[model samples]
Target: MALRTFLLLLLLLAAALLITQAQGIGSSASDCCLKHSQKAIPSGVVTSYRLQGPESGCLLDAVVFTTKRNRKICASPTDGTIQKLMQHLDKKAKNDKNKKKGQTQRPRGRAKKQRRQQV
Candidate 1:
C-alpha cells in the first residue's frame, strides 16, 4: 500500500511539472513580437500602428505599424513621429471603446425610444 501511494504521489508531481512547463512555453511564445529593424519607413506610408510597452517583454518599447505596402514594421519608441502616432492611435482606440460601451449600455426597448423621442 505504501509503495502504491508513493507511485501515485510521484505521478501527480510529474503532471504538475508538465503543466507548469507547458504554460511557460505558451506565454513566452505569445510574448514575442516582430523583431525591430534599423531601416526607416516614411511616415506617409504607414497605415496604422499600435504601441507595445516594456511590460510586453520586448527588448525596448516598440511601435508596430502596418504599411501601405501590406507590411508590418516595428519602429523605435524614441522617434518623435512614432510617439505622436502611437498617442493618436491610443486616443482613437479609447474613444471607440467608450462609444461601443455606451451603445451596449442603452436599454433595448420602447422606453429607450420614448426617452429619445422626448429629447
Candidate 2:
C-alpha cells in the first residue's frame, strides 16, 4: 500500500511539471510587429515575407516583408499591393530553388587537377 501511494505522488508531481511547462510556452513568444505600415514598399526591395496574425501570437494581421538589406517591414494583409508583392516573392523563391537543384555537379579547380596528375 505504501509503495502504491508513493507511485501516485510521483505521477502527480510529473503532471504538475508538464502543466507548468505548457503554460510557460504560451507566453514565451515575442511580439514582432506593433502596427502595420500604410506606406507602399517596392517589391523590388523585398526579398521575402511571412504572414503574421493573432494565431501566431501577434495582436494584428500583417505581412512582414524582409528586405534585401535584412530589414523587416510590416504591411496590411488586406492591401492589394502587398498581396502582389507576396506573389512575386513566392515566384522568385521557386525559381531560385529550381536553379540550385539543377546544379548537381561542380567543376573542379585547376589546382585539384594538377595535384591528381602529380600523384
Candidate 3:
C-alpha cells in the first residue's frame, strides 16, 4: 500500500509538471497568430501593426495589425493592400515622432533664472 501510494503521487506530480509545461508553451504563444484572416480589414480601424515569422515565435509569416480596440488581425504580407496600409501606418508614425521632436523645449533651472536676470 505504501509503495502504491508513492507511485500514485509520482504519477500525479509528472502530470502536474506536464500540464504546467503545456500552459507555459500556450502563454508564450498567446500573442502568436494561429492563422491569417481572409476577410478584408478596414484600414481605418488599424491603429498599429507588427510582422511575425518563425524566428519571431510564429509558425507562419504574417503582418499582424492592431485595431483601434486593440484587436490583432493577422494578414498575408504579400497582399498589396496590406503593404500599402503598412506604409501608411509607418509614415504616420514617423510624422508623429517628428512632431514630438519639433516641440519647443523651454530652459530649465539655472537657465531660466539667468534668462530672468538678463531681462
Best by lDDT: 3
lDDT of 3 by residue, 34-98 (tens): 78899999879999999998787668889999999988999999999999999999999999998
Higher-TM-score candidate among 2 and 3?
3
Candidate 1 on 1-119: residue-level lDDT in tens? 99999999999999998998777764533644566777866766776786677666555567778888888888887887767877776776799889888896856667633445564
**What TM-score do all the candidates reach, one by one?**
0.47, 0.63, 0.65
RMSD of 1: 8.9
lDDT score at residue 5, model 3, on the 0-100 scale: 100
lDDT of 2 by residue, 1-119 (tens): 99999999999999998997777555624656888888889888888899888787778788899988999999998988888889888999999999898788675566544445564
By the TM-score metric, which is better: model 1 or model 3? Answer: 3
Pick the winner on lDDT between candidates 1 and 3.
3
Rank the models by lDDT, top first. Answer: 3, 2, 1
What does the lDDT read for residue 20 in candidate 1?
A: 84
Model 3 — TM-score against the truth?
A: 0.65
Ranking by TM-score: 3, 2, 1
| Backbone clashes in model 3 | 0
- Model 3 gets an lDDT of 0.87
